[model samples]
Target: MTRTVLVTGGTSGIGRAIAARFAADHAEVFISGRHRDTVEKGAKEIGAHGVVCDATDSQQVAALADRLGKVDVLVNAAGGLPEAGPGGRSALDGLLAQWHASLAQNLLTAVLTTASVQAKLANGSSVISIGSIGAERRGGSYGAAKAALAAWNASLSAEFAPKGVSCNVISAGYIAGTNFFRGQMSEERHGALVEETHNKRPGTVDDIAETAYFLASPGARHITGQTIHVNGGAFTTR
Candidate 1:
């Protein structure tokens, strides 16, 4: 059966790769991006449908849900380090802006998107939210938001798992080939991250894509409400 899969932030980075993975399997994939042209372009490249949606906005998210029939898999991949505005009137103002941006982009996007489409999720479906290792480390505001994402998933799973729906968070780390760093990643920083990994290499988008694919598979039905770390040993759980 062709799965009806939806991926937010599918224009680039990890989200794009996940969408492509599903599309390659002939799944009925739909990708959502905040920009129209970017969504169209990404959809064309991945052979999937595209919707213009800023996941942080409830109205747009509602419209997106209305457009879908049944969603077999919902990947809440809309999030990143939001760029701070030009200036802040005061120190407190800047802090507020940064924290708000972090929460809205990293946390609220997933919450709003999932809630809006909650009814559309089919039985035996999956809800996978993209998370970060920052939540377990020096993530600051962004990390705090991601940690909350996992906490929310726990409750979400308990509510949905009884109906054959699985919820999970994929906590990724040091993934390369994406604009995640916003062009601020220095070579020294990159090397330091890679050195900490067991494999001595940075993660690829495909790594997380494959993990997402597996978690949605039948083998992963018993793996709900868990945070699957894909950091290549950069962050290990004892």
Candidate 2:
């Protein structure tokens, strides 16, 4: 059967890479971005469908689910360390804004999207949410959000596994080719990250993309409620 896949935040970075991988396998893929032009362009290049959506918006997520009807694979890839917004009027307000932004962008986006589309998920379907290495150490607000994501995925997996669906999180580390650093990555910091990895290398978008592909495969049907780390051994779980 030709599967239907939906990947949120597929305009660039890890999301785009995952969408492209599935598209190459000839799946009927749908790629979404917060902007129309970027979504359209990404869809065109990858030979997949495109939709404009901010995954955190309930209405938009609902609308997207209505359009999808039945999704065989759902990848929640809409996340990042949110830019520090304009300073709040007060120190307390600023602190609140930063944490809220992190949770909304990283955690709630997946939570809302999954809830909106839960009914549409086909039997034997898979749900993959992108996570971060920061969740393990020194992540601040962003890391906390990803840790929450993993927790949520665990609960989601338990709920859906009985229905023949699997839910998992891929915790990525120090990927080289994304706008994730917001152009603020210094050479010293970058080198330090690579050195920590047992492989002494930065991860790539395709690394996560391929992992997403596997988790959706029949071989991984028994794997659920788990967080698979993909950081070139930067963080190990034993």
Candidate 3:
């Protein structure tokens, strides 16, 4: 049966690919981004409905939740690198700004959006938040925020598990095809990242999208409060 799926930041990159994957499966997909033009364009391109809402803003998120009815799968894929602040700033101040931006963009976006749509989510619904490998290594402020996201998801899953809802985070590694690098990633850096992966290749948007699809499937109902790492065996805990 077709499910109602909501993907934030679905206008581009991994989020867009996820939306397209669901749309191809004939699911009713609703995508959101901060830009009206990009949102509409992406929706049209993927054959999914689009809405202009910034996941970082609680009010906009509430409006978005209201716009879309009950959602069976909610993918919080709205996050990225922190924006550069004022120049000539002290190291401590720079770090603080980056931390705040990372928390706001990566962690708080999911928190606010999920909270806004909590009531509308159906029982047995799946909540998937996009995370990064940085959370586990030398990711600095960005990684710390993602690590916080995983912690938060654990608590959220426990709270909502009784209601039959499942919550999880996907810790992705070396993923390409997104503005993740903000166009600053050098070819050498990219090559090094690819070389670090076991597959000797960069992760694709479809890889994460397919995993998300499975997590939201009936077979994955028993899975909750877990962090599924999809890094081409680049990093393994087991």
Candidate 4:
């Protein structure tokens, strides 16, 4: 059976990889992005359908849910570092703006999108959200938001489990191929991150995509409400 899979923020980076993996499985894949051009290009490249919707916008999310009909899998991958707002601001102002932006981008985007599509999720369906290992060690607004996301997923899983729908978070670490660093990371910092990993290497987008595919597979039906860390042993939690 060709399951319908929806991956938000799938225009690039990890989300794009995830969509491609599902498409390769011959699933009916759909990718969402804020830009029409990017969404069309990504969908064409992966042979998946494309929808233009900003995950953070409630109206757009509702419209997207309406357009999707019923979905078998939903992947919330639309999150990243907050963009800097207005210029020449005070230190305190800048900090507050960043904090709010982080929460909105990292936390609320997933929350709103998932909530909007909750009723559309079929029994035995899967809902996966992309998270970051930064939530464990980093003490910043982005980390805080991601931590909150995990907490929320725990509750969401419990609520949906009875209906045979599973919910989980994938906490990724040191993944490359995205504009995550915004060109500010130095070679020394990159090297240090790789050294910290037990494998002495960074993760690839395909690594994440494979994990996500497994989680949504029938074999993982009993594995809901869990945070699966895929960081090359960079950080372990028993």
Candidate 5:
């Protein structure tokens, strides 16, 4: 059966990889981005449908839901560090801007998008939210938002488990080949990240994408409300 899948923030990076993964498997895939051109281009390149939507906007999210029927898989991949805090203002104002931006982008994006399409989720569906290693360390505002994401997933899974839906968060660490750092990552920082991993290599988008595929598979049916870390031993549980 061809499952209908939706991947937000799919224009590039991890979301793009996820969309391509499902599309390659002959799934009915749809990807969304805040920009029309990027969304269309990404959909074409990945052989999936594209929709222009800023997940942060309620009206746009609602319209997106109206465009689709029941979705068998929902990947909330829309999230990242915010650009440019309220600079030149008071330090408090800057801090507040960063916090608000972090929450809106990293946490609220997932929350709003999920709530808008909660009714459209098919039975036995899988909802996967992208998280970050920052949550486990000193990620500041961004990290805090991701931590909240994991917390929210626990509750969301409990609510959806009875309906045969599985909800989980993937806490990724130091993934490469994405504009995640927005060109701000220095070579020293990049090297530091790689060295922190036991494997001495940065994580790839495919690493996360494959895990997501497995979570949506029958093998992972029993997995829910868990934060699966894919950081190459950068962070581990005892």
Candidate 6:
């Protein structure tokens, strides 16, 4: 049977790639984004359903849950580093804003969306929350949020495992072909990031998409409550 899948922040980059991968396999995919145009465009391009809903907003998330009564796969891929706060703010205020925004975007978005869809997750459902390699080191506010995400995934797995559902986190490294840097990363910084990886090359969105696809497959049914690293050995686990 074709499974129903929901991917948040699926308008571009890693999220969009994941949505496309599943759509190509003929899954009933629904993608969400904060903008109407991007969501519609992405949905059309990938032949998946589109919903303009910010996962960070509770009301919008509730409406999304209503629209998707049940889902077999839920990919929480909506998150990114926010630029500085509004101009003319004190350093402390700006710092606080950055932290709050990071938490809301990276951590709370997954929390709220999953909570809203708790009941809608069918038996044997799979939940994959996208994390960052920044959580390992020098991530600053964004890293903190991602660290908390992995911690939450542990608890989430325990809760869902009893119901035969799998919940895990995909700790991704520096992936190319994404607007993640937003044209802010210097060429030197990019090279440094790539050099840090064992492969000496940046990752691709497809690498992550394939990993997610496997985590939801029957073979991965035995895997749960784990953080799978896909960062080309950038951050090795002991």
Overlapping backbone residue pairs in candidate 5 total 0
Give the per-residue lDDT digits (tens) of candidate 6, residues 11-104. Answer: 9999999999999999999999999999999999999999999998999999999998688999999999987678998999988999999999
Q: Give the per-residue lDDT digits (tens) of candidate 3, residues 22-113.
A: 99999999999999999999999999999999888888998998887788999999998888999999999998888899999999999999
Give each model a TM-score: 0.98, 0.98, 0.96, 0.97, 0.97, 0.98
After best superposition, candidate 6 residue 108: deviation in angstroms? 0.5
Q: Give the TM-score of candidate 5.
A: 0.97
Model 6: worst 10 consecutive residues (lDDT sum) = 115-124
Candidate 4 deviant stretches above 4 angstroms: none
Name the 10 consecutive residues with the lowest summed lDDT in model 3: 62-71
What is the lDDT of every predicted structure here? Answer: 0.94, 0.94, 0.92, 0.93, 0.93, 0.94
So what's the TM-score on candidate 1? 0.98
lDDT of model number 5? 0.93
Model 2 residue pairs with clashes? none
Candidate 5: tens digits of C-alpha lDDT, residues 1-238: 8999999998999999989999999999999999999998999999999999999899999999899998889999998988886457998888888899899989988998888889988778999999999999989999999999999999999999999999999999999889999898999999999999999999999999999999999999999999999999999877
For model 4, the local distance difference test gives 0.93
Q: In model 4, what is the error at residue 226, expressed in angstroms? A: 0.7
RMSD of each: 0.8, 0.8, 1.4, 1.0, 1.0, 0.8
Query: Which regions of candidate 6 fall more than 4 Å away from where they truly are?
Result: none
Clashes of each: 0, 0, 0, 0, 0, 0
Error of 3 at 46 (Å): 0.3
